[model samples]
Target: MSENEHMLAVRSRINDLAAKAKTPEGLTEAEKAERADLRQEFLANFREGMRSQIEMLQVIDKDGKEVTPEKVKQIQRDKGLRDD
Candidate 1:
């Protein structure tokens, strides 16, 4: 599945688990493990999406100087994330 699809699935599962835990008794061990795994997947997807947005960003000073961070530049260069 695409990242978006996977993320949606993860979110749905996490929500389901949360609703289940509102009952008299909480989730079973296996359900708890699944919830944890889904939460991890959701976080991983969130971080990757945030990283992509940051990578696509360019910081310019009042002098029109490109001030993007050195590490970000290197990451872009290494990964060919940008065209310029």
Candidate 2:
């Protein structure tokens, strides 16, 4: 499938799973398993999206110093921002 179609399918599945989770009956063992699977899928997609965003940002900031996670956290700490 194309990227748009794939993203739409993922979003639709996420919405369906969220609706199931919100019901008062709650999730059964099987539904809980399905929810875990959906959560994993969503996390994987989110991580991939973040990586793409980082790549795009790197391209945009080509003239700037490359910032690693460790460095960013250190900078946040130095600025008195919450690291946790």
Candidate 3:
């Protein structure tokens, strides 16, 4: 598989693990810890992806406006947007 495909597979697996963790018959303590760590890793990856997209948008917009996370959140709130 390509690198992108591998990354997608890993992300899918992480999502599956997260869903499992959320169940009432959830993971054991060690499994839960592992899931939490994986979730954090996924979150970091997701945040980085969002930052990159925001940077691209800032370049495209190029209106001398700062694009911080707060700004993004405010825009989302104003526009009634939610992350899928």
Structural similarity to truth (TM-score) of each candidate: 0.81, 0.52, 0.50
In the range 1-84, model 1's lDDT, one tens digit per residue, is 996787788898899899999988889999999999888888888899899988878899999999999888888988887667
Between candidates 1 and 3, the TM-score winner: 1
What digit string (tens of lDDT, one per residue) describes model 2 on residues 5-61? Answer: 886787787687778779987667887787678678878888999865653342224
Ranking by lDDT: 1, 2, 3
Query: Model 1 compared with the native: what TM-score?
Result: 0.81
| Candidate 3: regions farther than 4 A off | 1-3, 22-24, 58-84
Q: Which candidate wins on TM-score?
A: 1
Could you arrange the candidates by TM-score from highest to lowest? 1, 2, 3
In terms of lDDT, the poorest run of 10 residues in model 3 is: 52-61
Clashes (candidate 3): 0
Better of 1 and 3 by lDDT: 1
lDDT of 3: 0.68
RMSD to true structure for each model, in Å: 2.0, 9.8, 10.7
User: Per-residue error at 2 for model 3, in Å?
Assistant: 5.8
Q: What is the C-alpha lDDT of each candidate?
A: 0.88, 0.68, 0.68
lDDT, model 1, position 26: 85
Give the per-residue lDDT of model 3 (tens digit) for 1-84.
Answer: 985676687688777877887898877788767777767776787888887576434222378765446666666556566342
Each prediction's total of clashing residue pairs, residues at least 3 apart in sequence or on different chains, is: 0, 0, 0
Candidate 1: list runs displaced more than 4 Å: 81-84
